[model samples]
Target: MMRVKHGSFNHVEVVEEMIFAINVGYKVNDLCTRCSTSQLSQSRRFPFLRPVRFLTDSRDVLWIMDTSEPQIDGPDPSPAVDHGLLAELESLRQSHQSLRSRSAEMEETLLLAQRQREDCVNEIANMSKIIESLCSERDRLASRVGELEELLKEKEDKFLSKFEEELIERESMRVEIEVYKKKFESVEEEMEERGGLLSRSMEAVQTVKDGLIKVIQNVDDDKIPETLGDENGGNGDLRLDSEFMPVFEQIMEVRKLVDLADSKVSEYKEMKGKEKRQLENSVVSLTEENRDISSLLRVALMEKEAVEKSLNKLKGNTEQKRVALLQFAERGLQRVGFGFMMGSGGSIEQPMVESYGASSTGSKSDGSECEEEVVSLASTVEKIMKNLRLEITQLRRCLDESRSDNERLESLTTKQAQQISENSLYIKELEERERLLAQNIEELLVDIKETETEVDRWREACELEVVAGKNEVEERDKVVTILQQELEKTKSALEISNGKLKLKADLAAAAMAAQATAEKSLQLADSRATGLRERIEELTRQLEEADSRERSGRRSIMRICWPWRAFIKVNAGNGAAPRFPNVRRMLPEMQSLLHSRV
Candidate 1:
């Protein structure tokens, strides 16, 4: 038996082994496989999703337990279902509504996230601009800072260098002062010595004056009267009053001497006055030199004091600048200490060390540019130096070349001189030769004249001989006539003798020509033989060289063959050698051919 929990519940006991099937929120079929029971007809009931409420007898409301049938697991439906199925369906609808509400809330969240993303992107853009602006400011500040630093360093270096140079100059000036002081002291000593010399000369003049005064005082009145009478007295009176005359003359001479002494004293006084004037002039000159030196010293002292004051002022200024720079550096570093976003977060951050660093980088870039400019200047300077060096080298080379050319010209001049000398010598020789030739020519002319005279004489002799011959012929003719008169037969014998003489003269001329031809032929034969012998010698030398090469090659080949021959001989003893007798025999034939050619 089954008990129903709600009004919608239906239960039936089955005769067979019964099984209950519960499907919440689903209708049951008439035939349930698990339950052998009568089918509960649920189609007649209207489906409602209201909550099951039960009223107790006391009018108290009690909610009923939901007995909805389980949903079908597969395609099969449950056999029975109560109103619980409607309640389950209502609950599912409520859950779906709640899920929809959650989806809407998620969409709102997504929209808010997107808005925040846009704001963040905007903020990032602003920050980027701020950073860029800060970077620019930093670069500018750094550049300024770097420039200041460089200027400071340069000024300091200049000051130091100037100080060093001034110190060295001062040292040099001090040395010059010391030398001048020594010169001044030596001049002072010389002036003192000169003063002493002047004093001594004055004393010597005073002593000379004293001695002359004493000599004048010794003259007497008697001497003066005698000297006055001696002008009219003779030699005998002078001898009688010799003593008196001599004393008188001495007194007169003394008076003249006193006058001369007075003149000498005046002259000496004038000379001493002149000397005093010269000494005064020298003292004035010395005083001027001393005044000049004192003035120079005063000027030097003033300049030194001024320089010291200026140097102190400069030092103070430098110190002040240094302190100010240090304070600025410290203050700047402090103001730009590390921090997050500033009051103007999206705007720009205050520039600090980073700004200075950027500025320094910019300044460094400027410095690099300056360095490049300097480098270019240096390159130009180097080029100028190179040009100077090249010019120097060229000048030196030119000088050397000029020197060489000069030397060459000098050598050529010397050669020309030698050639001139040679030419002069040749001219002299030629002149001598000409003189000799002239002499020879003169001798030849004389010889020619003599020869001409001889020839004339010969001609005369020949003429005379002709005449004699003619006379002889005439005498012969006469004789013939006489003979003819005596004996006519002798005439034929004389004619025969004359014909023989003519034949002898013709034979002598032919013999002379034949001898000349013979000599010419002998000379031609000798020249031909000499030329042939030279050609033969040349051919022989070539042949010898060729033979030497051939012999050397043959020797090398023979040396190589010797080893092979020895091997062959040894192999032949072992009965392993090849024979070629004809090749060995051809060597002698080849030698014979070469010998025959030679």
Candidate 2:
């Protein structure tokens, strides 16, 4: 765009590189004093004898110029047409060099796009592998949770069945107590009926004996034999009576019955006492069993509820993640800029591009009109390329952001993994506590069964009139009660364990939620990476398409150049073609560069 010197040196050598001044009208936008600010005008100073046509190069720069000029000796003479042949040639050479530089710049832009596309492809492959591994790990965790739930249910069923058995044993003891009460009442009735008869008989016998003793006293020593005989007479008569003999035998039988009844009463008392002790023992056992086991069950229930809530939360998170993935897949290009630059670039192909043929056919006038049109087209291409470059930069920034998101997702995954491991450790501790509690309960139940059997034997012995110490049963009951205390302690421990398990489950759920979030982020990153890869692929396709278009455009320009080349050969004494601006030779290096990047 530098101003051409008015009086530079003469004898400037022209070496066939000329006539590129048509599209250079862009340089004169501010060069002319009377040039309209609203629209572009062309340079009229360049030497041209008639309407001439020039071809565009492979850079998509518009060509097919009409380079005709007004006669040198016009009414309005211009300083531009008065230049020596050498000076005109020198300016043309400069214009030709500038065009070469512009083509090179466009080629460099295409190669860079290719490199970026390759990098995007590499990144996507790595991210996909990471996502796959994470998915597998999540499946393993879900399996572990299911196994834990099944184990808990089994334990609960076993405990409930043992409790029911204890209840059944208590119901049998009640039936034995009722039978003892009825037998005790019959014994009381027999004692009252026999006692009254025995009292009357003793009084009559005493009166007879007293009368005999008084008669003996009156007879003194001589009457001693008669007194003795009188006493024996009544005794013999009374003894011979059927009623007396029966009365004597009835007294003996009543005494025997009373002795048996007394023994039976004593045995009943012992049995009743034993029953009372056992009832109290059962009461204590039931209370302990209810207290410890029930509390543990409540804790377990709470834990189960927490786990269920967690599962529900996890389900919600996963559902949300699925929805997000679906949305990303549908709108990934818009959301992640996969088609952002492409859309803008597509718009750059406006209707103004259609005016090239019309302008080329226009009547020649110092060639300024065509130069101005070419200049306008040049400016438009530059603007579009700038915009495209900016979009490429934006896409690059998005790729960087997605990478950062991936790094953050990795960090979150590690944190979640750590939390999961901690939850596992906590779960293991809870399982061990639960196991210990179960063992204690089983042992206590065995002790209770033994005590029950011992009590039954003690009651049997007392009923058979074989005396047995009550202390032994009492001691056994003490042992049973002690075992119950241990059972209670174990139950409390189990409750604590359940509570801990609940906390751990909650923590695990939180971790799983976080893991789900990380999974989503990873999925998003993966989608973004995939989008970048797709965009890059599209960009490469566009680049290849542009390359094909460039080749066709080059061929068209060469078609226009063919006649110009012949014209050059007729003027040149050497009879050979010029070598500058030959992009056909550059194609091999361009292909090699693309291959290296690929």
Prediction 2 global C-alpha lDDT: 0.47
In angstroms, the error of model 1 at 412 is: 82
Could you tell me the lDDT of residue 123 within candidate 2? 43
Model 1 lDDT per residue over 304-325, tens place: 3543454355345435544654
| Residue ranges of candidate 1 with Cα displaced over 4 Å | 1-86, 187-598
lDDT of 2 by residue, 1-598 (tens): 1222212311110100121333233222212212221121244443343233333443333333344566475444355534543465577567676645644543464456456546544544543454455445445544554564565556456556755675565556545545544544553454454344434344333333333333223222223233233323444445535434444444334334444554554565467457557545644654563455345445434543554454355445445544653453344224222353356434323322433333332322323554555454455445444654576577657656655654555554455555455555655655565556556555655766565465455344333221111122223344666787899999999999999999999999999999999999999999999999999999999999999999999889876644335444544745355433343544666545534543
TM-score of every candidate relative to the true structure: 0.20, 0.25
Residue 363 lDDT in model 2?
28
Model 2: how far is 253 from its true place, Å?
32
For all candidates in order, the CA lDDT equals 0.43, 0.47
